[model samples]
Target: MTTGTTTGTTTGTTTGTVRSRRLGSTEIVYLALVGILLVAGVLVAVRGGNLFAQGNVSYMLTQTSLLGFVAVGQTLVILCRSLDLSVGYVVALCSLVGATTMAGDPSRVWLGVVAALAVAAAVGLVNGLIIASLNVNPFIATLGTGLIVKGFLDTRFKGPEGEVPFAFQTFGYTRVGPVPVSTIVMLVVAAVAFVLLTRTRAGYHMFAVGGNLDVARLSGVRTSRTLVLAHVLCSLCAGVAGLLIAARFGTGNALVYSYGLDLDSIAAVVLGGTLLFGGRGSVVGTVGGVAILAVLDTAFNVLDVNPFFKDVLRGVIIIAAVALYARRQIDPASRRVRFGTKVSAVRRGGVA
Candidate 1:
């Protein structure tokens, strides 16, 4: 019994040590992004550009807020070991649907917003049901759903149509001093997401479900429900983003921002150090990731970099981020440390 106690104690110490070290490594990635942002700002400044200028900063925040909303949703879906390719079109559809509802009268703008959210929620529910119940590959399911959304939009409208209410547009443009209202919205969403993931039971279930569905199920976690919730929330985020877009532009365009938004949001989530395989991530990291992309994109424009090359650079960044995280995941030292503790626990007659 004494020997078992000693072994358990040692195992606990080893596990704690490993966790601390791993956390440090994760923090480094976020800090590195901060450094990158500072460097990018300096480079932009060196080129006689003011990255910190009031106007530019406001613009960056507004744009980042839009992308950030989608990225936050992507983070949740990925955390559940699922993907939401349908989000891009969800944005387009919500924009069109909501704008269509509000076109007749400005007083009905709130109704349009509610209608857009309902559409988004319905689409998300279908996605969750199909993938969770049928055991369909999340990637394939979401992609198919996305195509369907695109088809619906195509058949419904040829180009930009409908008008957003003037008041709604004004709200989108409202600024709190130098900060835009949209940016405030983004920050609030992020804060809520951060709290949910880090401080709530549902968040814990999501991470567990993402880490291992079978284990989560064995633990009475209701893995299917968790996954469905993730997708639902993801769609809601997309819906909000669509509304913002409609308000910002005062119209909905089926073609606008259709191509890169999905990829960009995924890239931002990955950049924030969230594992693509799911389970391990932070909303703060996602925020950092979004800022990195925003900084780079802004820098590219200010530096006169070719538009074509920006895409290439973005692809490279995504690949590099994935590779870096993969390396950390498979590191022999970390793995051995984690595995060793379990092995020791088992030898001591404990359930590893």
Candidate 2:
């Protein structure tokens, strides 16, 4: 009976370990992020004396919407093994155009919004074409396009007094039962993006193309079209983000928060466990990543830390996350060895 019990126990332990290993890498990263946030929240609450404050939670969620939208788009692009460095400038330009066009006419609000989206799509198409047809690297191509977009915005505004439409402002500022309109919009967009990327045939093709373009082409996937569509969707998301910002601020400044937006989006996506090299990620992870970033920023503010330090800290965290992710990809055996070594070291120290 004792021998049989020992064997059963060993079998159960092995089965449990196997089940744990089956969990997706994204899920593991997400849990790590959640753990980090929880620890931060606890520390902040211990210091500030409140974790359940309505004001703090609302402020964090509201601020998250901007980066959240951009991150969702970035997730899609990265999944396709491409990057969009132009999102920040594209956003600035779109917001400027939307704000300037809507400044006086509430009736033409929809028209301006449509035009902004069209321009964004056009910019994306140009990026896709340059990269695909001309054999240009996506990084350089998007960077160059971003510069052009910035210059155009600078020339268009020539100053900071661009008018934004009242209706557009309403979309940014209006609340639905204490939730900001922008937040609602972000959620809706995320949900739609999630469904498209996970539940559709195009999504499968996207994964195939990202993982191995040559293989994907040989498998009869429309690789070029998939790349173009990914960029278009990315630009569209950026345009929507710009519109939300314009509505929230009630004006369009040529350089308003453009510099940090792209970095934040990239960081958010990476932290969500999407491999920078591509072929893996989900909108759900991206949202959680956004929430983690937002929480970190809020915690910094509540603790009276310098806002500049937040950027520095964000850079550190992003680099660390990426490094860890890369290590996970390249050295699964190394991780296991490291884990065993640590355990042995701990036992030795305890014995000593």
Supply every candidate's count of residue pairs whose N, Cα or C atoms clash at under 3 angstroms.
0, 3
Candidate 2 residue lDDT tens string, 1-352: 4444465456556656765676565676678767866887798878965644777777777878888888888888889898999999878877877777776678878877887788889988998888777878889999999999888877777756556677668887677765777888899999999889888988888888789889999999988888888888999998998888777777776785455788789888988888778888888888888987888888888877787887898788878878877766764544555565566556656666
Candidate 2: residue pairs that collide: 102-165, 103-164, 103-165
Write down the lDDT of every candidate, Cα atoms only.
0.85, 0.80
Clash total of candidate 1: 0
Best by lDDT: 1
Error of 2 at 211 (Å): 0.4
46-159 in candidate 1: lDDT tens per residue?
888887788777777877898999999999999999998988999998888888889948899999999999999998988999899999999999999999989988888899
The residue ranges of model 2 lying beyond 4 angstroms of the native Cα positions read: 1-22, 49-51, 330-352
After superposition, candidate 1 runs with Cα above 4 Å error:
1-26, 334-352
Q: Residue 156 in model 2: shift from native, Å?
A: 2.6
